[model samples]
Target: MSQQSSKPEAPKSGGWIKPAVEYGPIVLFFISYKIWGLMPATAVLVAASVAATIVGYLRAGRLPWAPIITTAIVVVFGLLTLIFHDDTFIKMKPTVVYTLFAATLWGGLLLKKPLMERLMGTSLKMDHAGWRKLEARFALFCAGMAVLNEVVWRTQTENFWVNFKFGSIFLTFLFMATQLPMIKRHMLPDPAESESKGAAGE
Candidate 1:
């Protein structure tokens, strides 16, 4: 075979690409709203979502499911907000998104497919028990987030809600940090090392 044929395949988009696209729109939305207002911010968010999707596809050679879903939601709700000139549609976006996540997670568990395991199993090496427990925790956390958004949007000022939208990213990181210990404890054992230890014992 030619050396060219033996060359490694190019890697797809990962790491910073995912989070930056996911959260960058929210940050821009907050800034836009602070400077202009909700309608304009919503427009900026919708545009950003579309741009992020295109960027992801251009870099990765295929569209990612998360960004596609996010773009769809943003475009739909953003249009609704602009059409009606009401903030209600945009404000309920987080609640709807989180509720969908919670529902998807629970449905996956019901179908005997752990949600997190299916989504992150490639990157996260954890035993079945860990995956199951992590899935449950994530589902619960999503539900909590939905409820929290409902409360905040229904009770707080528009400015506060915008701030909370940005703050939610921080909350997500905090939640993951809390799971580090559990994840480490439940990581899959090293098979080769285990076998070596068993051979030594024998």
Candidate 2:
């Protein structure tokens, strides 16, 4: 009789708290900017963003490109806001972030890869076809977000934009949750073990 060995299971996914650590600064920035207004709050918000960026990099054991770039931009714009006494710099932050995200996603599509796959590479497993479909959906969502951001900021008050930014995070969570069903349905099972189980049963 031969003994069979079982393979190790994959690690469990990290909880939402992990992502909250990354986005918490943006939430704080929106809150502070609205409650205190840009003049008095911009410095504090920028500092928080910088701190969050550092914490994120430390937690991940490497610097993430998006948060690092965003932190740098926030610091530069925050300084400009202070020096010029103009809120326009701070106001443009969302536009810049969304535009960059949109461009990256669309560019990935052009290059025959999805930017989301690259970002989530270590976190999930899916086949090429699954990746392609997921990537296309994510790219479209990013583009839609970019347009929606522009529309809200242009048509609404500063406070409205601030609220919208905070609220939009919920939508992102929902979108991610919706993909789980598709992922489960398309995920490949362990074929060799399954065949062995069938033989044993027979």
Candidate 3:
């Protein structure tokens, strides 16, 4: 779910490394799909996804759950698609992933645990109520995405679905942009500032 790290550094020279390593395989898969076809694309995606995960592990010293889980599903569904000569399995990967994410988030809430908090707590300091609201909204959002993916793949052409898959990044960015205001509202006050104010009050 989260990439564990000993030290985090912003690359000064190879600033493009992270994005390249992350998205290169996806771009390759898309290109392969257009040139080759469904089964070839599935094969290409499985190979590229695994390569990406290896790159990530070599860079970060561990496999982050997001990519690892994604790669696993890709391998499973991709192999099924290849073996069965059916593209249906490959088309359903996003739905399966989104559903799993939604269930995990909601299930964590039911267990009185905030899974996202464990993953992102160091970066985002929010109160209990804030975290609950954020998690609930994100869970619903993922569920909606699952349904939307199913609708698109079921009703549309494969080419259209492929375009939608890439274009969905814009929608995701817009959604996150809209959450900036809410994030600001729920941001916890700096502890050092609070301590300084308390000392001054005395």
Candidate 4:
């Protein structure tokens, strides 16, 4: 008789695709900015942002609030860049977005709710305390990033700010990766469920 082979199932394409779709526009904007300059790049970015939002809605059958809001802001600021012939508006976009996000996160913590938990409600499992702590940390990090963006953009040029945005995003990704172990450790397991399962087995 031939033995049956068993293999672990691969993760769904849907799981990884959202991040790629989200970042693709940013990458395109960076490249276009390098080759074509801010105005043309902002135009491409505005288009990409619109395309991303459409794709998000089509794929999920509903609009994601974050991307929808981001797209609107980008379009408005991008138009300002083109209409006024100044890049300052575009440069300030990240600062505004980050500051708003930071405020939301921190404010949620003050209200005894973690905004991140609401945002990632379907994806992860965590108790109220864990979520609150995570929210506090995220709020601090976002606030720090907003301050850093302000400092860099005010002291540096457009190219430098663009580079900083791209580089800092990668750095933040790495920082999150490093925190996964801590997150896993702090996660609360269902003690009653585990005990029932053990009793059933015994």
- Per model, how many backbone clashes are there? 0, 0, 0, 0
Pairs that collide in candidate 3 are none
What TM-score would candidate 4 get against the native? 0.84
Q: Which of 1 and 3 is the better model by lDDT?
A: 1
Candidate 4 on 1-202: residue-level lDDT in tens? 2332211111233454456456767888899989998899899888998888777666656654666777888889989998998888888887777787788888888887788888765456777877887777777777888799889989998898888877876867876887687678767677779999999999
Per-residue lDDT tens digits for candidate 1, residues 11-95, read: 2246656876789899999899989988999999999988887887777677556567778888888889999998999999888
Whole-structure CA lDDT of model 1: 0.85
Ranking by TM-score: 1, 4, 3, 2
Provide the overall lDDT of each model, using Cα atoms, as 2-decimal numbers.
0.85, 0.72, 0.78, 0.77
Clashes of 1: 0
Q: For residues 73-111, write the lDDT of model 2, one tens digit per residue.
A: 888988998999987787777677767777877788789
Best by lDDT: 1
RMSD each, Å = 3.6, 4.9, 4.7, 5.1
lDDT of model number 4: 0.77
lDDT tens digits by residue: candidate 3, 1-202: 1343422452321234444444566677788878997678779888988887777667666644666787888899989999999989988988998899899889989988878877667667987777777788889988998999999999999999887776666666677788778878888999989999999999
- Give me the displacement of residue 108 in model 4, in angstroms: 1.2
TM-score of each: 0.87, 0.78, 0.83, 0.84
